[model samples]
Target: MSNASTSPFPLAACAEMLWRDRPIEWRASRLKELGFGVGLWNWPEHDIGKLEATGASFTIMNGYLTGRLTDDEGADELIRTARETAQIGKRLGVQRLNLHGTGLGDRGLPVQPIQVVTGVMWLKARDTLSRIVELAEQEDVTFTLENLNLPVDHPGTPFGRAEDTLALVSSIDHPRLRLNLDLYHAQIGEGNLVELCRKSLPWIGEIQVADVPGRFEPGTGEVNWNGIARALKAMGYSGPIGMEAWASGDSEEALEAFRAAFTI
Candidate 1:
């Protein structure tokens, strides 16, 4: 649990979202200097050695390169890639490895979109996550399944809603496999943010935030992030809160706004 005097939750910001023109290592180092842990997306796009040199506390990163959650072949590929990515995650000392319902492509669209998810697909997704849990246990790492917004960000993505993710993770009920409760997506897909957090508290490994209108930092848009911060503190959630948002203007100012929102 984080100390209330310092921060209500351990804070992190996505390096990929900040300083788009700067070098990745420079962004990581700057984030560290600003007292926030760093979050990463796909590892292959950047140099691991450079990231390690920055000495940032890596909070999370994408778990697999390419795979889906609702089929045998996709599940197998997911496991294999996740195993490989775990090695990189360990190398960087990343706290949580993130997963989506399926692999994302250009502009966050699902590579293999599904119009309807069948009952068998649900069963298979559950079973597949169980296998991921086994892999996580074997590798001594934690994996988080994140919910995505279908209407705006990920159209036709099956099992992309918070309700579906909560159902799956709660069913598994394993520490190695937890929910990466992304409030940005939830706010867009379903608006009862505080209530959603209350329901997801048990299975949440971490919480991600971004303002609703522009996917920018806290206080720049519609979300009452400070109120939600208080709500999370009241709910006894002392885990990582990551800012996975773009800078509306200056990146440093954006980060400061994020810090203020969750600082309690």
Candidate 2:
């Protein structure tokens, strides 16, 4: 746990990004030594028991939803998959699972403005997500909807804007459904980081960080880390902010810079 006197949010190490050459257990042990309160993991194959034994909290496994919710069968499949994921969360003693919204058209072109309009897809997705949120509530887990900025990272992802993602969460009106505000993607897709953080504070379950221009540590890119950290602190956002960036040099050096920048 982080000292409340300093940073409001604790820093979490992304297992999929740092020290990846070693086994998951080794990585978890290292994070424990480094005082990381949580580890952001994506795959299901990891040894959850080993990770837990190391004393570093881990996020629930994440994966892309295969079918579109617009069709009956697809919606059914999406709900069933969410139920299964919730079951996995319960089994692992993890409380939060992150998920991505619909991907946009093919990569390599300017994001068409029409992509933002959810249209019928919103109704279908909302209905499907409602049932999924119910399952998540029953399992005592949260599903965080991450906003992936399309033009930079996703290229053609539909739910790239913070407004659309916030609207989805608001429309769902479920306690178990929340947003995962990834600052890196948000900065690339939209420059107003602090305002978005303030507006989405109520529903934000997790926050991930990396610098823009390149997914590197805070000082390596153009993002104003000092300002962003101050804003998060001011808003009383206490969730763990994950370090999801790639290390530009020595890993320890990168971490030190992050700590110094965030003043955590």
Candidate 3:
């Protein structure tokens, strides 16, 4: 629902991640009660301004990475919506635009060489990212690419690893395209957390935190929160740490576990 933030402080999300039908204004007020604005994902158009009205800070912007961007027209629409969202985020003073780096079309493509030179199917991926960066720059909203692995990522999935996502940042070479590193996913996708964070450095915009097993709170699952926190400290990462994981029980229990594990 939220980001795996180092602060151990709960960030905002829709219906606190339950996905139940609720008003954005209501959600924003609830998020304020919890102390911060959430990365708004499944929100309506009218709520965009309303969520910002609640004084909750924006963390992530969705609407582009779902089953929607499977075709060319959808891709253009995705970019257009993304550009508009970036403008909204800028007006709302949100710092990051979190996005999924790949789509379904990314799944079936085969990697091959051209003219004795092996190259990735970077054309489609590269083009989308370029447009995202250009539009984000217009709004001054820096981008954050979250590492989504497991079953979804295929050979052609745009970016599944921290380095790959970071490489996109390098290839696009845009200051806006950032790595939204999720520690839990890293353990599954790429385990060298220290090195990944070290390599990404300034380009690493946001971080999500959670343990393995059930992907519950840090303590409930299996990540070394203390060590990870130390690594984050070593990297001099000062951005918001999101508690992005499943809850075992109620909100209180979830937050308590989150604090116990993350408040290093």
Candidate 4:
């Protein structure tokens, strides 16, 4: 990373910490009480103002890109959800929304046939994306396409790689549609994190972080923050950095673990 200075990194919480294995409610006030910033996903619409009063801004919360594509009638549901989230976030003063680009499935060993079908699926997925972008744009929130990590335990997904993510962004060519890079997902799905971030500096809109091996904290695992952090700094990113990790313990303990990890 050839940068003269490193930008300040903001610590934020993602939905999994609050809603993965437990209730997602009460996350905002808990964060406010604990003095944390950077909203991840599933923000409480009921008390968004109070959450904002805690001096935290939303980085990127979940969106309905995929949810809108599920059923024929789901389109309306997606629009309504996005509109509501945007209104709630706007009232809370958040600027970004992160969405899972598309779905993934199993592939064979050769993977040739699978790639072809997946490519077609990804192309079809553009229709869903178009709807999402239009809604997000109208709502005044930046929509970022999050790259899938392939589940490793599952199968192949259509939009898992950086190349695929960029391809979708290029295809859509919408100002609201941009890159939402996840370090843990990239570590699991792509190669050479620093190199990839360098190559993709221009496309990245927001960065969500968690360490590798177990998606824990910085020093709690094998992820090399020294290089990635330097590369992010070198790329001149000044957006909110989020914690999109799972809580191995209770919420407070998990928050403590994350805070401890940031100290590294």
The alpha-carbon lDDT assigned to residue 39 of candidate 2 equals 49
Q: Please report, in order, the local distance difference test score of every candidate based on alpha carbons.
A: 0.94, 0.69, 0.61, 0.62
TM-score to true structure, per model: 0.98, 0.86, 0.76, 0.72
Q: Name model 2 segments beyond 4 Å from true.
A: 1-6, 63-65, 68-70, 103-118
lDDT tens string, model 3, 1-264? 343443543344333453235666675666556555466553344556676677776676553444222235645866876766666667667667677644333332322212121133355566777877877766667877777655433343445567767777777777778788777778777777777778877777677766776666667765677677767776677676666666666654665565555455
Residue 180, model 4: lDDT of 84
lDDT of 2 by residue, 77-186 (tens): 65666667666566556557776654233442322333554477778767867876877767778887778777766755555577768888878867798888888888
All models, RMSD in angstroms: 1.7, 3.6, 5.5, 6.2
What local lDDT score does residue 117 receive in model 1, on the 0 to 100 scale?
Answer: 98
User: Model 1 Cα RMSD, Å?
Assistant: 1.7
Cα deviation of 123 in candidate 1 (Å)?
Answer: 0.4
- Span of ten consecutive residues with least summed lDDT in model 1: 1-10
Please tell me which model should have the higher TM-score, number 1 or number 4: 1
Q: For candidate 1, give the lDDT of residue 45.
A: 98
Name the lDDT value of residue 2 in candidate 4.
9
Candidate 4 C-alpha lDDT tens digits along 27-50:
654665565555655554335555
Q: List clashing residue pairs in candidate 4.
A: 104-157, 105-156
